[model samples]
Target: MTTNNIDILGLAEINVNKNMLRILEHMVQDKFKLYFTTEGKKGTGIRFLVKKEFAVYVQQFQHFEGRIGFIDFYTKKKKIRIIQAYINVQDKEKPQVKRLYKQIEHWTNQCLNSFVKDIIIMGDFNTKWNEYEFLDISHWRHDIFNYFKKHFIKESTLVFCDDISDMYTYIPNNPNHSHNKIDYIWCNIDLMLSAIDSKPRDVQPVIKTDHRMITLDLFMDDIVINKNNTQKCQPSSKTIYCYDEMQKTDGEWNWDKFNKDIIEYLDNPNIKLTTNKIRGINSHKQLNQLWNLFRKAIIHSAKCNIKQKKMKVKQNCHPLYDSDLKRDLNMLKGMLNKIHGTKLDFNDRSIENRQKIIAHITALYRRSDGNKSNTLSDFISITKRHNIIISNHFLHNKTFQYKDILQDTIIILESKYINATYEYKKNIMNTFIQERNQNYKTDKKKMIKSVLEQPHTSLSIDKVYKNDNNKDTFYTEENEVKEQTNLHFQMIVSAINCEKDLSQHPKWQDQYQSKHDVQHTIYSDLMK
Candidate 1:
């Protein structure tokens, strides 16, 4: 579990099932959303927890037989891929290790083919670096490094930290065992270079886990609206306010009509009072009815005021100036659109042209002193201000707060929202599968013809069995394959048998509870 402020969290091992996952979602649905892969039998798995703000941007998730989890998503229009893996602990499990690497290679190639360049791979490799006896390690760190290097990914620990080899990410409780760094975060070379800053955080041993959590922050250049503006585009807050538009008011409230309605309600003979409830009210149901009466009165007043305001003469505040500014902005965008429509190569000349147009637009909104207006520095500034106005109109207006009732309402609504979302995603996946199957059926003939024209074969092996002395070591191919298969199966079984029970003490719960309590208090206070 992670604090709500974190944008992304990667959890290596956890026992989570569909029902349990739904419960987790219900708890954090308002703040974060989850995507995961679980080993079915035990529900032991890895999960990628993305903050709600970033959930919509997650385009795809790839789960690899419960060993790896990958996500492809966009942030500020930048396509980035994240891969989290938990490798085997045994040294002799070469087949598993190779399979993991093959998956990485396949994913990297797939991303490249799709033109998504930036990638970050992180997780527990279960191997420590040994400069003197690298060959003795089961899950060789050198091989891992070499494999990543081939895909142009560099370990962030080594790239961003000094004396990287001396850093310890995992520490065993046993006195005889020494601490060593095995977990890692790797990023594409280009992404690293483009990042404005990158660093790692060390965890204290008191955290209760044998492996210290590794956190890396890679800040990229801010997205600016134009060359003339220096301001950055910040993401908007998730909290939004909505109000009923049909209840608009333009004049002062009709107090007489409102008073008459309240009088009639109070004089109704059907109304009853009982001693068990507060202030002679029968139950919460009666209190709610009174609250609704008050609400109706307030809304009626606002609507009457809105009608009066609508009758007044409208004011024209710099109509010509505003219109001209908007026209200039649209014309600039049109020019850019025309250039894009031409399908010209993105060479220096085209880029220069684009810059010139942007600068010209910036000049239109420049201040009298020949400096750009602070509010117009970025497009987001305008949208941000609009949102602020709307939120203020809804939130700052006088309102009532019923703590226990409101909290209960929020919990109920969140549960329904999350369940609906889950079902929606499930429906989308089902539709996609059905459509894919139908397409395959429709293209069967063409696919078969293409396959017949260019028959596929197994890829070439990098190494084959050989005799060092050039002696004849020939053996039956069938027997050799069988022996290799048996060896792989035996290694897997042995590794499973040797696996340690790494579950933490039940008392070692995530610090999320206290933090969530604080957040709830703050939110409740704000609502009040």
Candidate 2:
């Protein structure tokens, strides 16, 4: 499906069960709209996943699981139906094989019985027209091939092949056995005429499966037009699949409706809400049980009242697609070609396949190794290059002794942010400082060290200021000198309150000074 673009794709001989399909649906739920078969067992079951873009066009789909499936596309003109059939036989007359074709014939008629006329039947027929190297298949092929021919249908892939070897879809593991041309694409003459190749093409087994992925170039004549916007939808072009239809089902999940429905459902007496289902939520095990019940209740209410809204497409979508109902045989002349415009490739397997094969192997390699120097420089590789002749030739007759370059680079930036060559500026600054100091001498008398016990004001909390030698700030809150003075005052105040019993406590010691002693000491510092 990936070698070329495809709008709708169906798989045969897949063994995915319903449970497994649900898991796969969740993984790709955002991308594809999945459809399943009615067959109970998993073996050889058919599965269809329409791409989100064209899923809007899928009006209806039905399948018998492992046997046969058909999907109807709602085209602008009429409906176009595509059937996927997987019929396996042992090359012998059997009622089971006949019954399968009877079912297929019935399904084909069902597609034609309604408004659907342009029907495409494709899949693994699992049997060639001839057995022993295209010998004859009149006995069995007559019924099947001629039956489709009545409606102007023909095999799109194998019948047109000059040699089966050029396009063998399925190859058996046993090398000795002949490869088979069992897979095919059969379509209505109206749709076939619009095909780019008419005859389906085959891409080699880049895939791991034994069956070579067959392809067809279809719906090439049309273009997507919206007012002034035009999307050149080539298979190789990066196409933006519009999933608005699939994702916008019923518009969006309505919380109001959901809540109302849940409340009503819980109140309904007919629906039992017993202790078995209403498991307690006290412990981990009970909580898990309760969670399961809660989820089920939500799901039940959701099904009853919460279908959002279906997206609608205007009939006047494209004038190219418009046609009168009272047409002759040319009604479907270009309908199939127009379908190639969008969403039909929703089932393309390449979308998933592309994720696995990281597209730009070389680009990733270059990015990670971008910094590496593949060609090493000679001077740079050496341990020492202080004397490397940089710009030697350009400087002087192929000699790179550069004064301006070295002078700008090799400057002493010791304590200063910038380099300066003026030693006179430094001497002038020193003379000015000495002049200022001489002027300040004897200008004011300096206060001698005295009982300047504490700082007059407290520091603000906006920011803390500290000097390099402020050791007490490291241990506690105050400066070392201020802390000691504060402690001395605290002891004096305590001693004054209990002067008679000051000696009774060892903590007070005998250093409790009296008022006369304090007055004498305080005056001495003031006098100094």
Candidate 3:
């Protein structure tokens, strides 16, 4: 009943609310039937909201293709038909828009040819009337405008408007913005005249909403003449029944073909076999139970190992570990470990496992390279070699036997090896350090143990040396000087803590001392 020309960005920001519902309620009356169309990423979609009483009778709803939102609502009223439509705009310069208009025209004409007696088309037409004065007519695409005008006045009967005061439904609210009169309500001529004969009132404009409410008051007495005057509906009952039967049969046939193809593919020796063949037949509840059990087993195993390492580090039993360092290592392992049993299965494994591996690899690659330029395709190719190994083993199972299976397996393995050797080498090097604790040497191990035994303070010489091998005699001497300067800083900090009033503390003296010694020490030793 109400249609506004909504700016795309503004529309995105606004949340759907009770106010929107209130507007819709005023438009659709007693039947409580509402149909709405909106544009989304995939294109336009139409939804119907019928009151529960009428829902059982409402058969089908469809949106026309190639148009932004050309919706058709088909309903049977006392064995008669009615269709409500919302057509799209045609922009001349865009061939695609013009093509959509042609499609709507063809579709509308076909619908009019059918048995549908009552048709109501409403919405923003995105065209201007003579009274509208914002946009220049010379600059406007006249050809497209003319086509719509011709179709509107000639093909359909226009509903009379009582109030024509405000034609501009959409005001951009900017001084430089263009304005136009583009909204309308139209009905079939035959239906309009019959309703008009009963002395229907002019359409009234609803407040707040832009579009005016158009109503046709129908009398029961007038139906007697309309019944006798009804044209022979083009689609006979037999023809409609046959069309429906064919559609049902076609759907069944397509489903059967799809099932057969799936079965053949599962049984084939050439394609890599998977447990999906068995799992696909099981009920969803059963599959979920198995999936959950597998996930728990894998997660428990990974967590147990992580917890043991943390306990060892906390007890000062492992000299190689720091609490913070152990936490990070456990976190990384937890992230890489696959928790779901469903993820390890051969068929579902490809997509889920691939995503997990990609995420892991991408994070590592970014950390190493300082950018995301590393190709995921190279990593994916490497993983495919593992897939080939699984595939060869699956084909050699007793259930599958093809004469050329071994030959095909050999060819696949050779191709995988050629593509993935460099990638495999890189993956091995990166994962090798975590595979075993290779960084812990005897001296370094002792250093970590010494640091953990003492209470937390500024990092000691031994603690820093455990992590950094470049620190030799010169580095240690410089660090010792830095450590002594830090002790002097701690004494000054302790003196400041004793003063209740900040002003009582010698601010000038403290500032002068800090500047004289601290700055001099930092610049003379470190900078030089």
**Could you estimate the TM-score for every candidate?**
0.41, 0.41, 0.28
**Per-residue lDDT of 1-528 in model 1, one digit per residue for the tens?**
354234677777675677888788788888788888757644247789887757887888887868788888765435688888887757676777777778877887765443324687888877775542244444343576676766667777676566665777777889799888778788875456444433444455434466777776655342112335556654343322222222223323444554555556555545523344347676888789877766765566445432332233445553322443333433333333343444433343454655543443344455577875531233324334323222323211311121122233333333443355456657887986676667578977555555457766665332234354876443347767556555556667455435433345334445323464465666556634
Model 2 error, position 102 (Å): 1.5
Residue 289, model 3: lDDT of: 64
| Pick by TM-score: 1 or 3, better one | 1
Q: Can you write out model 3's per-residue Cα lDDT over 1-528, one digit (the tens) per residue?
A: 223311010011112454575586576546456544443324233434555344444454445541223334333322122333333344443565566556545655554433233344444445555433334555332443454445442222123443344444444557687654455444444344334421112233533443332334434333333445566744322211122122212553333443444455445463433577454646888667655655554454333322221112222343222332333323322222322222333234355655553453344334354654332233233335345333323322421222133234333443443345436556776765443344355456545655466655565442222223664432346666576555556667465424355455788556534465455657557544
User: Candidate 1, overall lDDT?
Assistant: 0.57
Report the number of the highest-lDDT candidate.
1
Those runs of model 3 whose alpha carbons end farther than 4 Å from true positions after fitting are 1-39, 42-57, 65-93, 131-159, 162-168, 175-179, 196-528
In Å, residue 294's CA in model 1 sits off its true spot by 38
Provide the lowest-lDDT 10-residue window in model 2. 412-421
Could you give candidate 2's per-residue lDDT for residues 337-455 as a string of tens digits? 32333223323446453332212111222225466321112112220233334442332231122222222222211112111213434667798667556655643222111123343
For residue 111, what is the lDDT in candidate 3? Answer: 46
Candidate 2's C-alpha runs over 4 A off are: 1-3, 38-42, 91-93, 112-116, 130-134, 158-166, 198-207, 220-528
- Cα misplacement distance, residue 273 of candidate 3 (Å): 92
